[model samples]
Target: MAFSSGDSGGSMADINVTPLIDVLLVLLIIFIVTAPAMTMRVPIDLPQKSVNPPPPSNDPPPPIRLRVDANGQVFVNNNPVATRQVEANLLNLLPPAMQDGQAVEPADQPTLELDIDRDASYETLTTVLAAAKNIGMEKVAFLDNM
Candidate 1:
């Protein structure tokens, strides 16, 4: 039993907020701990922007086929052409970006696949290679068959 001595006896009017404050603070800490887990983030660095261009495509552009036959005949894509015309013809096949007598990145240029006939004269191969090299064609490779 409780009694008041005031003129008008009344119950307590001020609320005790200590427990409320404690509950609120605990809930806030729980949310802070669980918020990162909710996002399901894996520890990694995602680029904010495109730092480097996308990796080069797996598929490469078609290669130019330069075939030399045993008869010393020079062929550009299976079409016979004169030895003197080989350099001009190969340069014609080049993309516009490679003709400036400047260095071009290997990835930006087309490839030259030399398919020299097994019995083809070595002199013909040398002549064709020289012509290609003269015009700054550096992505040349040899074909094993034909």
Candidate 2:
């Protein structure tokens, strides 16, 4: 067999991947050495579970729906009631319903649900809330349209 360089030639030009493999091995070793130091150590205290049952419902009576229109008119239980008479009306109605004679239990107290029109002012809503508060009603909820 005879080998020629120029006119009578055979191709021997090919890229060897041995150098690439060596480089990748070196990078992998470097990452393994530095990986532990680069990570942030965190101490976590996870919560434990308990088999205790929840306390019984101390929920108030059925909610009284109060609607306030754009004109600042207040409605108690769907019936229109004057703004000035709101506190008075609530005071009169709530006590009797909750009280059996003199003693009124905490569980018997009714919740208040306020449904105000989009055009209604915040002042009117607050006033209605104030009335409920004055009448000793604690649980109050605002009605929103989905």
Candidate 3:
């Protein structure tokens, strides 16, 4: 009987996982090496908050409009003016109420609206922006046709 037990005929086989473990380790190493290279770094500066509140206003604000046509012509409050004269006109046209040396009053800054044609060049738009900056008009906005 003991000799007959050795006559069993079924063969046993097992799958080896060494190759799969090696492939997984290689992939993990590749990802770890390339991850930092694929990422980008950017620097930004954030603003701080101010605790003091703005002063109160007693009078209605004035409106200043500057328009740029497709031909690069400039207009101040609907009056056609040259590009060279924009700075001077903006400085001169500042409301008298905003003049310096008055009492501690709320800013009488005029609301500046820029109307630019769709075909206007960037040079023209930037020139107007520089002029507005030179004249100390801080509250400038763009006018869009609805």
Candidate 4:
């Protein structure tokens, strides 16, 4: 570092950059050393790809059919069920294992196929939907009669 002796009558304008360049070179070397370590491969046990497709299991049980007539009549598998008893009827359609309040997996659950008439009132549709939902029925498919 050069300092004005006071006789020069002006401040020194030269910057001391030797220390800055040394620090930058040290940081550059540090980054270069760590870059290769960061790129080191981590051995992950990924699943092997299989060429053959998995064997198909037996067909799932038939879905429970629910039909609603224009007169607001709800039917469980063709059996007439009052609007209030819709939940009970649907519950009865489940397997014996599920009727005991055991935790049933979604795959093991019976699917409800709703065949609603076009002339059915919105109230009837919503009521039936609410009943199905209250029974914790996860799979409900709507049948298009067109």
Candidate 5:
């Protein structure tokens, strides 16, 4: 903060770092204030159930199979279905007790077997997953190498 008198024959060439430090501190404060906002919670349709399914039944309904290929096409038991129809398809596959828009208990929840192709887009997978959750399917497993 020292200001040399102008009477000196040569001008001072030293860099003033006080102002630079002040500017940097201000920027640091601003970023810290905005950091939490960046991580604010968003309401997403996602399931919270664990992968462990309930005990086996005498003859449990067959698991629903979903296949997603590179082109983002979704197939249920080899039948092609649009991404938007997945929720409805899941509802149709469930039994009467689990199909009335009420949250299904884990024992009554159906298992979804996902066979994702090697080249499928991440978006396609997420979309299919969201549809399942929106319909409240809790048991899901990802098939490997297909």
Candidate 6:
């Protein structure tokens, strides 16, 4: 608090801004100290463009499209498959190593595109998803069949 220097020796009504300035300066110092740390980047190993990279030898395999209709009928590549045989049918489409219970390499993993009817039962959807998961088919995608 500051006292008035006028004839009236009462306390000044004006705000005491010295403390506010001090606090602002302290905050400014804290931000200055932390600014560099905040912007410290994580070093990433980005792939560099090669001057003469070799052309890819072969095209990737076409994605397997699986369709599930409103009646819960499952189809693999447009061929109707029984609900009990869905897993086997999918396994047949995969590479032999996958069918033989071997860990699949990422490059050899086949993508499964699921085209599901909106009116399809949740039970049917879950069954399809469970089969894919159990078979270690990681690249399953939902197709907008509308």
Best by TM-score: 5
The TM-score between candidate 6 and the true structure equals 0.58
Q: Local distance difference test, per candidate? A: 0.80, 0.73, 0.75, 0.82, 0.83, 0.84
Prediction-by-prediction clash tally = 0, 0, 0, 0, 0, 0
| lDDT (10s digit) by residue, model 1, range 93-113 | 876767667776656667889
Candidate 5 off by > 4 Å: 1-54
Candidate 4 TM-score versus the reference = 0.57
- lDDT tens digits, residue span 51-132, model 4: 9755543655579999999999998989999998898888888877777877766566778899999999998888888887
Q: Estimate each model's TM-score.
A: 0.57, 0.52, 0.56, 0.57, 0.62, 0.58
Which one wins by lDDT: 1 or 5? Answer: 5
Q: Which ten residues in a row have the lowest lDDT in candidate 2?
A: 98-107
Rank by TM-score (best first): 5, 6, 4, 1, 3, 2
User: Which one wins by TM-score: 2 or 6?
Assistant: 6
**Model with the higher TM-score, candidate 1 or 6:** 6
Q: Lowest lDDT 10-mer window, candidate 4?
A: 41-50
Location of the lowest summed lDDT over 10 successive residues in candidate 6: 53-62
**Per-residue alpha-carbon lDDT of model 3 for 1-146, expressed as tens digits?**
11233557644455667889999999999999999988966432333565985664677477788899989999998999989888888877777644442332335577788988999888988888888766666667788955
**Candidate 6: tens digits of C-alpha lDDT, residues 1-146:** 77779898688789989999999999999999999999998553344677976554365556889999999999999999998788989989888788898996545678899999999999998888888877878667788875
lDDT at 142 for candidate 4? 90
lDDT of 6: 0.84
With a 3 Å backbone cut-off (N, CA, C), the pairs that clash in candidate 4 are none
Pairs in clash, predicted candidate 5 = none
C-alpha-based local distance difference test score of model 2: 0.73
Q: Candidate 5: RMSD over Cα atoms?
A: 4.9
Q: How many backbone clashes can be found in candidate 1?
A: 0
Off by over 4 Å in 2: 1-60, 97-106
Q: By lDDT, who's the top model here?
A: 6
